[model samples]
Target: MKKPHLIVPEGMEFIRDDIGYAPAVLAGNTLYISGQIGRDDQRQLVVDKEAQFVMVFENMKRVLEAAGGSFENLVEMTSFHTDMRDLPLFMQVRDRYLQGVYVAWTAIGAASLCGAPGYFLEVKGIAQLN
Candidate 1:
């Protein structure tokens, strides 16, 4: 087994320095991305539900790129939502980002995420690097 390499994208140092967590970890060719919330580049929670979904996917994309990968490299993804009713809207936003590249995905419902009230959705993924 190869040692895992931590991935921290620029401007995301707070994830490790302040949150004490690696945003993503690359073990050999597999990149395990941590759950990404609906926060903008400024780390502020996005208020619009649909836009918030976009931010979550965008954050995940940043992590994937940091690991030398892209959406095409994603093998599996898991999403947690505070409200199941948001699934329709979430899927709409997700499909826009994913385009026609379909990967194994699982959507779960949770009471809360990020240990905060503003966050309604969180997504994490696993990607295979070239």
Candidate 2:
């Protein structure tokens, strides 16, 4: 069997150096992605909730694409949110990204995140090779 490739995107060093985790992991046919924050491709956090949701999903997509996978292949997801009020807005945002794809999802409340003013939410997921 061919070993699954380990992929780190060209500009991902910012994630490792400052974000504090590997962006994605490919072990055999499964991909385990680290939690993605509301940061741009440049790694700057966007404070707007709806906009941040889009930004965070974009980050997640980049990692998934690097692993040769996509959202439709995802089986599970967990979201951590500092404010519960944002949950409904998050659902609206999530629907935009997850159209036609159903993922087993968990949403949790958190007191804080690693960054100041904190993120509206953080998202993580697992994907199977298709």
Candidate 3:
């Protein structure tokens, strides 16, 4: 059995202290990333919808990198959005970060997220590490 390894990327300390959850956890070849929101390093949520969408991916990228993975390594992704109307904006931002890698993804509409008021979306993913 492989032991679970917590991924604590630099500049992501706020997630640990404020949320009490690891940004990501590596078990064997798989990395399970926690739901990432649009909050900055200071734990402040971004106000703009488009900007917030981008920030979610950016936060996930940091965790993936820390786990020795990249966007191309992602095998599945699930996103939670406060409004389904923002799907277009979220897709645009996702394309920018994911490039052409086509991974299994699902987007769900949610009423809100924990600790992030005014945030429009959150994303979590599973990645295969090399």
Candidate 4:
């Protein structure tokens, strides 16, 4: 049998989206994390899109940690948003966390996310393990 290339720790999701895909996938020294939405572990859509944006980003951080990686290891990021007008706010909040270790980023205007009204953003990331 082929063993998993990376070991995701307990409490981290073992995502196998039957109808779609997972939050992340690790192969070799590279991790391809799927876009993260603004939902808690219970799948509740956060009340505010921007707040949820931050939350989802934080969630992504946790997922990275569980997989033995750090935010600094991220090489790229992509954000999908329902409203492009909220870019400044998103940038403000996103800037609060990441410093000079800025990764390549792309933001797109989206129609709707996977859930409720306030849940308007999703973030996906790619990281290379050290």
Candidate 5:
């Protein structure tokens, strides 16, 4: 069996050293991405709903790129939302990144996420790497 490779983007070492988890793990042709919350490059939580939504997707994009793929490679995605009402705006920002490459998706309503209340969304995905 091939050994799994941990995929951590540049400047994301905190996710491993502080959080104790790989941002994503690549096994053979499959890439398993961890749930990324709405945080800026400085790790500060974003306050705006739409910006937060975009930030989380950017985080996922970074993980995918580190694994030598893009959003187009995503085969499955799961998202958690603190407020279900944000679905419409979330879908709009999501579509901007996905660009119509359809993937299996599940949106879950969560009471809270990332051990906090301010985070509005968290997204995790699986990609098939070429």
Candidate 6:
């Protein structure tokens, strides 16, 4: 049986230790990532919708790289949003990062997130490592 390895990427802030959950985990060839909010390196929540969207993806990118993968390695993704109407804006920011890289995706509308009040969205995913 393959053991699951907890992945803690350098330079990324994880509240998991203080709270309870890993940012991501590697089990076999798959990397499972937890939901990433638009928190900055200093742990401040980003208020701008577009900026927050970008930050979410950037955080995901960092996690993917730490797990020895890239945006192209992402097989699936799920996004939770406080407002579904921001999908267009979210797509705009997402396209800038992905630049045509395609992956299975899901978007969900939620009333609120765990601890982020001004946060507009959260992104999580699964990546296949090479």
Number of the predicted model whose TM-score against the real structure is largest:
5
Instruction: Name the runs in model 6 displaced over 4 angstroms.
Output: 13-15
Q: Deviation in angstroms for 100 in model 1? A: 1.5
Alpha-carbon lDDT, every model: 0.89, 0.83, 0.88, 0.77, 0.91, 0.87
Considering lDDT, where higher is better, how would the candidates rank from best to worst? 5, 1, 3, 6, 2, 4
Best-performing candidate as measured by lDDT: 5
Q: After best superposition, candidate 6 residue 103: deviation in angstroms?
A: 1.3
TM-score of each: 0.93, 0.88, 0.93, 0.85, 0.95, 0.92
lDDT of 2 by residue, 90-113 (tens): 999888888999999999999887
Q: Which stretches of candidate 2 lie over 4 Å from their true place?
A: 1-5, 15-20
lDDT of 1: 0.89
What is the number of residue pairs that collide in model 3?
Answer: 0
Worst 10 residues of 2 by lDDT: 12-21
Where does model 4 exceed 4 Å of error? 1-17
lDDT (10s digit) by residue, model 4, range 27-129 = 7778888778777777677787677878887778877887788888899999998999988988887887676669999999988877556667888888998
Q: How close is candidate 6 to the true structure, as a TM-score?
A: 0.92
**Which 10 consecutive residues of model 5 have the lowest summed lDDT?**
11-20
lDDT of 6 by residue, 35-73 (tens): 998988887888887888999998998899888899888
Q: What is the lDDT of residue 48 in candidate 3?
A: 85
Question: Between 4 and 6, whose lDDT is larger?
Answer: 6
Worst 10 residues of 6 by lDDT: 11-20
Model 2's C-alpha root-mean-square deviation from the true structure amounts to 2.2
